[model samples]
Target: MPFAVLPAQICDVEPVYDVYFAAFKNEPIIEFLFPGGGDRKAHTAGTVQWWNHDRNGYTVKCVDTDTGKIVGMASWDIFWRPGEEGAWPKPDGAVWLEGEQRTKAEGVLVPLWEMHEKLFGKNRHVYLPTMAVDPDCQRRGAGRLLMQWGIDIAEKLGLAIYLESTEAGLPLYSRMGFERLTYVHMIHKAEVAGTEEDVEVPLMVKMPSKAKGMAFEDWAKRGYP
Candidate 1:
């Protein structure tokens, strides 16, 4: 049976976080990183709160026709140029705003925007921060289905998508119509890098709607490398 892509509700937090962690567990070896751990319940609650924020968006997966048991997830946002209504603007390469740049870009001003705009510029880009599938469900096309849902939504909304990836996800994103926008090199604190966490991320971008005519399936196969 096909995994269903659905709007993730606040009640589905636990399972969604489970999938998020499982899908990225190999992140340590794949990219030498992991999100902060422990108190998964609290983390889930926080994530639910974060994703529900007005500036962000998300989609999740569950077994078709069943009570919500989130098996996969993809979260995104609509990029607002710095000077537009509800826009957060910074002078080019401004570092003073660095302390606020969160992954969700809530208070993120410094590091996040500089890094974000450096690649996407001041356009309406679709921001996909996390995409993961449960470990028990790997190799079963769950990730692909979730990703296609993201692509479909992006196309419908007429926005280009942007993301950063660990080593394991590079091929998958490439196949989903994303291209290498730039590479970010990081030197984590030795303690952090030495731990079984800390990931190296490579930023990527999906070709804009106007770029080409490749069918989704064909594009998925060709660039999935």
Candidate 2:
């Protein structure tokens, strides 16, 4: 079946949250964000709210045309204001982290912010904060279709695209023209003897495509700004 990519509406929040939660339930960053396994659902919901409310980003959903179901989604924003300072803002009502998890998150994010500024440095660009496909919808082309929405816009604007890629997502992003810039490791504190581990997340960027001179009207007709 074919997939149609469209901008998400406010009513799409619940479904998008479901996909995001299920997709990342076992991801290391999710584990770090909501340690102790308590209030996981609430924390995830809070994240969705933050993305929708605080970030004011453009969200695109990939709908399976035959069934009209949203199988994948990606949220992106332009962070181009001059003189913006500090690390990326934490999600509103974010879950609390303690000990190693807090240290690890801070350690990873602080440097990630520095690298982002060093590389892009106030150039107008698209920043992808989240993207995920439904667990049941894996291996379909929905993810690629959703990503193409951002790629199209970035290509038209001649702006770079940036995202932090999880280990599971690196291959897909690489195929989409993103190159790894650096890696951020999040170490899990050992709850049981000899069980500590870490996850490597790569920071990736895709430079704008050479194809340019497309008008806004042309992009809008294709369902993008």
Candidate 3:
């Protein structure tokens, strides 16, 4: 059956966060963000609230056509037009992070701001900040499906796609026509329990073009974008 990719509704936030959290559970960045098995339910609620407001991003989920389950998800910051970006204000109850966790988030976002400006200053593009498939759902082309959704939109808008790729994601990104740019050290020594090393990820880009990632199955033969 053909894979199904759809706009993640607010109602799907819980499962979306479930896949995201589970996938990133062991990632160092996840440890820094929510030390010691943080509140997953609250994070899910916050995601719903935030989506109710206007944001320059999109979250999509890949469904298991056979079982009707959300097996993977991806969140993208779309900068399709020029001269976007201003204040960081959100609704009063829109924030999820707080206290130490909030600070850790800033530690990561702050450097990302600088890196983005330095690299693509004012350039229109799509940024895939986070994406994940359920551990049990790996190797099923869900990742590729979620990525193709972004690629399709980015190509249609004539925008380049950029992302900070984890070590495991490098090969897949490369297969998706993304070129490795440079390594970005967002933070060093997370200072969280059980994590005390520098945090760095590779910067990668896939300019809008005809090529698409044919990594899993026969997406190329299937005529995917």
Best by lDDT: 3
Write one digit per residue (lDDT tens) for candidate 1, span 76-194.
Answer: 66553343543333434322123322222222223445676554444455677678877877677878888888787777765667776767788888888787743354333334344
**What TM-scores do the predictions have?**
0.68, 0.71, 0.79
lDDT of 3 by residue, 86-182 (tens): 3222223213577767777666655666776655655556788898998988887889989999998988986668788888888788888887763
Candidates 1 and 2, the one with greater lDDT: 2
Taking every candidate in turn, the Cα RMSD to the unseen true structure, in Å, is 7.6, 7.6, 7.3
- Model 1, position 11, has a per-residue lDDT of 76
TM-score of 3: 0.79
Q: Over 4 Å off in model 2, which ranges?
A: 36-56, 80-108, 182-195, 210-225
In candidate 3, residue 113 scores what lDDT? 65
| TM-score (C-alpha, index-matched) for candidate 1 | 0.68
User: lDDT tens digits, residues 186-211, model 2?
Assistant: 23344411235544457777766552
lDDT of 2 at 208: 63
